[model samples]
Target: MSEKYATIYKTIGQNIRRYRKEKGFTQETLAEKASISMSYLTKIEAPNCDKSFSLEVLLDISSALDIDVRNLLENIYSQPTI
Candidate 1:
């Protein structure tokens, strides 16, 4: 993948981690709530990890976190290119 897309994924992952922490939800709990595996959640939250997640996954995460889908992508577009 290109650096720009990588940055976007990283930014979104960071936002997810931040919100998940703020909500006091562990990766396991969030994964169950989002109907995904803990391993997948770990991958998505890993900094510098080059995994690509789908929009459905993002929506599931947002729903599990009780936040808007846009919240998970907060500051993504503004992130500097890698």
Candidate 2:
């Protein structure tokens, strides 16, 4: 993947995790709510450079967290790029 795309994924992953933390949700709990495995949730929290998460999964995560998916993604892109 290009650095830009990889950065986007990782940054989104980080933001999801940060939000999850603030919301007092654990990986296991979030995974259960998202109907995805804990292992997958872990990956979502720190997605690999080459990994791609589906829109379905992203929406599932956003729903699980009770946050606007676009806002969550927008916040990451708002940061200065290296």
Q: For each candidate in the order shown, give its overall lDDT on alpha carbons.
A: 0.91, 0.81
Native-referenced Cα lDDT, model 2: 0.81
Candidate 1 lDDT at 18 equals: 96
lDDT string for model 1 (1-82, tens) is 5665898998898899999999999999999999999998998999976788999999999999999998898897787876
12-78 in candidate 2: lDDT tens per residue? 8887888889889999999999999998878768756355688899899999999999855866666
Which segments of model 2 are wrong by more than 4 Å?
Answer: 1-4, 47-50, 78-82
How do the predictions measure up, each by TM-score?
0.92, 0.80
TM-score of 2: 0.80
Highest lDDT among the candidates is held by which one?
1
lDDT of 2 at 42: 89
Which residue pairs come into collision in candidate 1?
A: none
